[model samples]
Target: MATFRKHGKSIRVEVSKKSNLQLATFDIITQVREWTALAETAIIESKSTDIVSNKTVSDTFERYTEEISPNKKGAR
Candidate 1:
């Protein structure tokens, strides 16, 4: 799981994994950075409003799970 918060002008993102896989940890961090960049772009494009305010952590998690779940099952 991951948690993200904003403090002043910067955003802080933390990622945690239940498994002991080192590769999974690296992958999660990479994914988070990618998502953060996409979100930043969205904010820049939508200059009228704040991007973080329009986004929900739950929504992001759901989308991520949906994308990865199929691959996980196939691997098993």
Candidate 2:
């Protein structure tokens, strides 16, 4: 299940299932809920024992620019 708590301006999301736990924070409630649902589904489906990652903010942005940003309306 996912636990939600208000952390100042952002919302903290904690999802724990089986012997695994995942934590994340988002400024938007919809984002938090979406992530929580996906995490729970992955856990219940036994996708992996560890859902945590070592990804950095810069790496995520780089991936977005390469894979997603180019598909946006302004991309040429």
Candidate 3:
């Protein structure tokens, strides 16, 4: 969600998703709204990419733990 507030002569914009938060101050309300929309879109896109990338890492680690790690000298 995005929150807007007045800060002195400028407008403060805040966008948050999960544990990530972004903040910006702009002199015009339209600028703040535009920034907020962009910020939210970027955050959502990053989250989708992370899920796809993490699956690759998870599969590699699982294979190592099950098949390769047990054969190592110090695995005991």
Candidate 4:
């Protein structure tokens, strides 16, 4: 699972998963910042008509993929 916490001007992201030996935590601040910047770029560069049509369709498919396949067993 992932948890996001906001404090003042910064955001904190925590990712956790279960394991047999120990628990691991990753502090992914830079990754979150990069993703936020990419999302902002996508919104800014997208045309209104594109957003109303193709952009919405693409976003829906992306969300569906993320929801169903967040990880892969052999992925690195």
> For all the candidates, what are their Cα RMSDs to the real structure?
14.7, 10.4, 7.3, 14.9
Give me the candidate number with maximum lDDT. 2
Q: Looking at model 3, report the run of 10 residues with the lowest lDDT sum.
A: 46-55
lDDT of 4 at 27: 50
Give the lowest summed-lDDT range of ten residues in model 4: 17-26
Q: List residue ranges in candidate 4 displaced over 4 A.
A: 1-27, 47-76
Rank order (by lDDT, best first) = 2, 3, 1, 4
- Write the number of the candidate with greater TM-score, choosing between 1 and 2: 2
Better of 1 and 4 by TM-score: 4
Clashing pairs in 4: none
Candidate No. with top TM-score: 2
lDDT of 4 by residue, 1-76 (tens): 4456775566665433331111222256776756545544444555213323346777888986787555756444
TM-score of each: 0.28, 0.62, 0.59, 0.30
Q: Name model 2 segments beyond 4 Å from true.
A: 51-76
Residues 1-76 of candidate 2 have per-residue lDDT tens digits of: 8899999999999999988988999999999989999999998999965655788889989999999999999999
TM-score of 1: 0.28
